[model samples]
Target chain A: MSETMKAAIFVKPGEMTVREVPKARIEQVGDAVVRVVRACVCGSDLWYFRGLSAHPHNSQIGHEAIGVVDEVADAVTSVRPGDFVVLPFPYSCGTCPVCRAGFESVCPHGGYFGASQAEYVRVPEADGTVVKVPGSPEDYDDETLASLLTIADVMSTGYHAAVSAEVRPGDTAVVMGDGAVGLCGVLSARMLGAGRIIAMSRHEDRAALAREFGATDIVAERDQAAVDRVLSMTGGYGADAVLECVGSRQSFDTALGLIRRGGVIGRVGLPHDVEISAEGTFYGNIGIKGGPAPVRHYDLEAGLLDAVLERRIDPGRVFTGIYDLDQIQAAYEAMDRREVIKSLIRF
Target chain B: MSETMKAAIFVKPGEMTVREVPKARIEQVGDAVVRVVRACVCGSDLWYFRGLSAHPHNSQIGHEAIGVVDEVADAVTSVRPGDFVVLPFPYSCGTCPVCRAGFESVCPHGGYFGASQAEYVRVPEADGTVVKVPGSPEDYDDETLASLLTIADVMSTGYHAAVSAEVRPGDTAVVMGDGAVGLCGVLSARMLGAGRIIAMSRHEDRAALAREFGATDIVAERDQAAVDRVLSMTGGYGADAVLECVGSRQSFDTALGLIRRGGVIGRVGLPHDVEISAEGTFYGNIGIKGGPAPVRHYDLEAGLLDAVLERRIDPGRVFTGIYDLDQIQAAYEAMDRREVIKSLIRF
Candidate 1:
């Protein structure tokens, strides 16, 4: 193993530099050293780089990945050398009250890895956070594994939105975004047995993917017109459930407007601020369920690893752009310019 | 029967005049003439008298009452002459789609009676809107029936708020406001098996009755302090459910602050124009459920009639003041001065 690993480091906001840094080592008792097989960029990561977030400068960058367990501490019993696993974005001890209640993402003592976007990562609580991939071909393939990376964050987030929305069988759901998370919401709604899935998007390319993911209808319009279209499609009763994948006020209003008198609205977008009218929500009998997506609760990394090995849901299609670790700045720029759905960093 | 009956008419806002008006005759196919034994003023009726509502001048003055069927139209088959019945505040046709879905109060064709505050009231959709009191004595009684009149409006409204709040057995509920609706909320919470009921009140008299009606705790304070007290009583987790019975901004904010995470906040008060913060509701996972109370949906009038006959719930305690038919202005004055929880007019 090399003493140094290449990493895409953010020296400051809007600045990314490829540097050879000392490889991550097992720092805690339950830590496991994994050789990163693949890592991807997320919309939230861009927030930090674009100076929109309060994240400290030079902080570790990415939070999504799939890797092999190259080393484990004495206290770690879940994985060993040569085992393939996916890391949950939020590293949870998996033994807190919130975790026991199935809300792991909000674990009181959880944090994330990939602070430096490196070739290798040290995962804390390895036994509790990493899920092993079964029946893997010995060779690590980027395409197959890239999809698994989504399970670590965005995919699980979409699942959270569906769960919060309480999407039941025979329900109609409207997803209000065309981002990766929104696309995953379309898939989640289908998996949850929503009879009708409406994806609200103006992007033709993304809308096509949403349809492939089982969207029964695509609302190309935005705002009030989009809400009207959704109501028109649902026999004037509005959708039974709405997923506010975009946290903007406009998206929230659309979700609220498209839901029926007794429907649920689940939100997962990290907006700067969102406000709802009491009169409107109360008069319409609308209920809202959302907060931070409890990614740890769904244990997506573990579940997706098994699902991926068994050829269930494909998440790799979300990755529309890829770049070498040194080209991290260009990746962020492309994503910001809406040139790609998502960008990935290759070691 | 006499060709005319004593009635109270609102000549203008804040003034009422009593005169001999022709006894109501059966005009609609389903209309039934009821000889009113008792009728009471409602808080909502005050809005019309104060010119805050769009009610026409000289319209009927009351909507809550217990009466006997004096005459029945050919189409009315549910009740016969001399049958003791309770009239639901809002008359529902009971066959509309909204009514069939258990939202009778919001029925498109539903309307209220007692436009003249008359001794003989005409009820529409008699077969569907009036419920006869079972096992009642042959002689008509006013006091006992007056207590049951609460179910026609305020009691039903309170029950709706509690139901919307999802008040379940062993849950703690906080009721905002000390009005008749708030008192009814205390009883409704008890009926719903709430583990603890906290009634917010500033009036000592109302607070006393609140306890009698089953409020386990009383927070006489208002605003933030009241919210803190409610939270303190619930071990800092906030109540499991909260009923916003007041329409003011302060009441709404207090209700919002008293509910726990993932808790329900049911609001039944009609607000003029209040801006509810969507971000505040979304980030906490709070669920809001409520609109206008479906008083006609749950057979409230029937239930109350039976309760009155059985001496189960006493609604008459709400009436603290009474006046002759011609003294309607005094009744309103007393209510405005907070000298009475409710007022009644006698001919």
Candidate 2:
């Protein structure tokens, strides 16, 4: 293996470049070096690429990926070299009190994944964060790989929203956003047995995807009009639960407006310019529950991975565009231009 | 009985007055006339009295009271004339979707008590809204009356906070504020079996009441110090749930700071100038869940009134000052001056 490999680096706002970087190695007792097989651009990456987030820290851009374990630290017991693995973004020690509570995203030693469209990536707390995919990495088809990749971030995030909102069977659930996370939220609500899934999508292509993902209705309206639409659909009452996949104030407002009394808003999107006032939340008797997605190792523990592996759920349809490592920048540009819902990069 | 009675009306900002209004009579089929026996000033009422809330519509002041049934319309089946009852503030038809969902505070037909520190009140939806005390109006003494009165608003609101946060037994809880609701929260948390109930009270008298109410610890510190104290107590992990009884931004911030990952902040206080940003809430995996207390018919349904009657929780101590109805304005002044945590006016 080459000592240096090509990896995507977020140099500054609105900029990401691919260059040969030092290959990853098992640096800690519970670490593993995984050779990248599939990686994807996330909706949140737009926060940096669009100058909404601060300039890059480490610059290795992508945080969601599927790979094969190339090396493993001696103490890592969960997986072995040559095993296919899904690297969850927020890597952490599995035993922390916060992680034990199933909020591993905010674990004690929590940090981002450096899987950034790279040839190789070092995964910390491998025993807890690296979810081994069944069979070899090469054995999985492209659709399965893409579906599993969603679990690493957006799919699990959407699932977290559904779970956080406590979407029981036969619930009227509204997913606010047209992005991958929102589409995945529609899929998740269906998987969670939601009776009616309303996708708040204004775009044609995204709306089509939302419907395909099992959205019963498409609310193309915005603001209070959108609220009225959902209320109208649900017999002048709003949804029993809302999945806020868009973290902006408007999306939050839509989520708040979408829920009936006693409903919960499963907030997954990274919040920006949004303030949940007590006046807005309390009077409606609405509950705000959810934060970042607790992907929880993005493994069998979440059940979605197993669903993807089995025939239970097929979330692969969310990947509207696909590319190779060499086309990393173009893939991001395509996402930035709204030319792709999400692009999967094959290594 | 006289055809007219004296009642308090909010005349203007910073001013309230007593007026000889027509004694209430059952107007709605589901209505009952209640002669006010014991009425108390609420912390939220202070918002109107202190000119923080807009000038009132009905001008009827007090919303928390224990009263006597003077008359009942044909359809009212819950109580008859001379029966003692607690008039929970937000009188609503219990069968409305919002009410049936247990959020009567915002019920469709919901309106203020019309209790207004008055001698008589007309309670609409009496069958669904009023709770008959275990005995006649003459049965309970001053202490029990005061304690039961707390349940109509503050105590139930406080309990709602604990419930909204899903405060299970053996969990650590924090109560913010030294007002009646905050003190009630401390007591309610105790009743809920919270292992450690921390009362954030800087006032010596209120803190004493909090401690008497079963607060395991009292953190008189403000801001970060208070948060640090709770964190230090809980091994730097913060409480499992927080009861926010102070609606200011600082109190909301304190409540957010006091909860660990997966903890809920049951926000019961009437919010003022407080906006809980998603940025502040989501990262901690924290949830925001309270609103105005539903009061749940103010009794056996709420479980707290029964708790009070059973002598398991004594919230009467929250009534630091007492007066007769003739001294209503003076009572309001004293409460406004912060000379009393809460004051009860006997008719």
Candidate 3:
């Protein structure tokens, strides 16, 4: 293996370029090195590109990718060389108390799965962080690989939102967002047996994908008007539960208002400037929960992977654009312009 | 049957005095007049006497009492003249959607039982707001009646804190206040089958009551140290659930830090300067719920009142000071100075 490899780095605002950086190795007790096969551009990736978050000066970027295990430390188990695997975003030691409790995304000794938009990634706690693909990575086409990438982050997050909100059979649910994660929330709510899924979407293309994923209705209204539509739709009460796929002050407040006397708002979107009225939530008996999705813990087990493999649900339909790994910059720009739902990058 | 009556009002900060005011009349179709027999000083009552909340100039102040029905409107079907009852703190009409969903505290037409501190109160939505105390007003003694008074607010609120947190058998519950409500929380935790109850109490006397009320342990430690102790006790995790009975910033944050993954925090204390990190809660799988307790919905049927009436629990022991109605000023001063746990006023 070469000592150096190409990796994507964020140089300045709205500018990303690739450069040769030191390649990853099996340094830790449970580490494994994997050769990248596919990576995906996330809506949250724009947070830094748009100057909404702390910028990294020539620092590695990206956290979702699928790969083939190339090397492993002696302590690493459950994965071997040449095995296809899905890299869990935000590496976690599965044996830790927090991970055992199912919050693998915030494992105490864990760190982000950054620099995965490169030739290889050194995943810590490899036995816990890497899930083996059922077959050879070459068996799946590029689009199918992109679909598998969703399992590492967005799809698992949507399932977390649905499960946290306690979306049950015969229940009606409302999803707040039109991004890839929100569309996946529509799929998850349907899979959870939600009788009706109402998605709060503004764009037509994503709205179409939401319907393809089983969204029964789409309301483009925002703020109080959106709350009004939801209330009126459920006979002036509201949906049985709400999936806060958009983590904004306005979206959080609207989700709070949309629930009836007692309902839960499952949130997975990263939050900023989130000020909540304790009194407002108390009176409505609304329960808000969700953080980072323990995607690795859920991926193959939550029926998402099998459903995708069996062609039961088309989670890959979220990919509206595709590019080579060197074209990551253009891919992000297109997504930022809302020209594509999401972009897939082949390694 | 003359119109004039003596009532307690907040004449000014640090000055709660009794004065002659117009007596309550059956003004609405669902209104009923109650002649107060026993009223207790709530720790929250000092919100104004201590100059915390907006002090109303000569306005009604109390919201918890056991009283006799002096008169009733035609629509008052549940109680009649001479019937003794427990008045729900938030007067709910019991027919609103929120009320039907079992949260009467936030009923659209509801208001606080403010005039209960005085000799009489006009209860709106009489059938829905008043619960018959299972006997005549002359049946129970002053102390038992005072105990019944806890059903209206404090005990119900404590039960709310426990229930909202989903206190299950064999679970560890931590109460965050040492006042009347906090003491009641200790009792309620036991009733809910909590195997161990830890109270955050510093005062020896209050701690004694907490122990008597079923607190298995007392941790006078505050802030991070308290959280550390709780985490250490639970094997580096934290308590299964926490009851936030003191709503200050420090206590709120401490309670937030004292729960293990997937634990719930039930809060009932009036909050000020409370800030929560959304990221912190989501990552921990923590759910927080509690506001105004729907005492009306829980009083007669949730088994709180029956538990007390059956002598299975004594919520009235929270009263460590006894005074006549004329000694209301002394009552307020004692609570403010921490001289008494709580005070009961007999008419």
Q: Which predicted model would earn the best DockQ?
A: 2
- Candidate 2, lDDT over the whole model: 0.83
Extract clashing residue pairs from model 3. Answer: none
Clashing pairs in 2: A10-A59
Candidate 2 docks with a DockQ of 0.58
Question: Which model scores highest in TM-score?
Answer: 2
In every candidate, what fraction of the native interface contacts is reproduced? Answer: 0.44, 0.79, 0.46
lDDT of 2 at B223: 91
Model 1 lDDT per residue over A216-262, tens place: 99889888999889878866768888988888878887787788765
Could you arrange the candidates by TM-score from highest to lowest? 2, 3, 1
| CA displacement after TM-score superposition, residue A141 of candidate 3 (Å) | 7.2
Total clashing residue pairs per candidate? Answer: 13, 1, 0
Per-residue lDDT of model 2, residues A66-174, tens digit only: 8899998999888998999888878878776677667888775777785557999889898778777788877878888888888888888888888888797988899
Give the winner by TM-score: 1 or 2: 2
Q: lDDT score of model 1?
A: 0.77
Model 3 chain A — which ten-residue stretch has the worst lDDT? Answer: A300-309
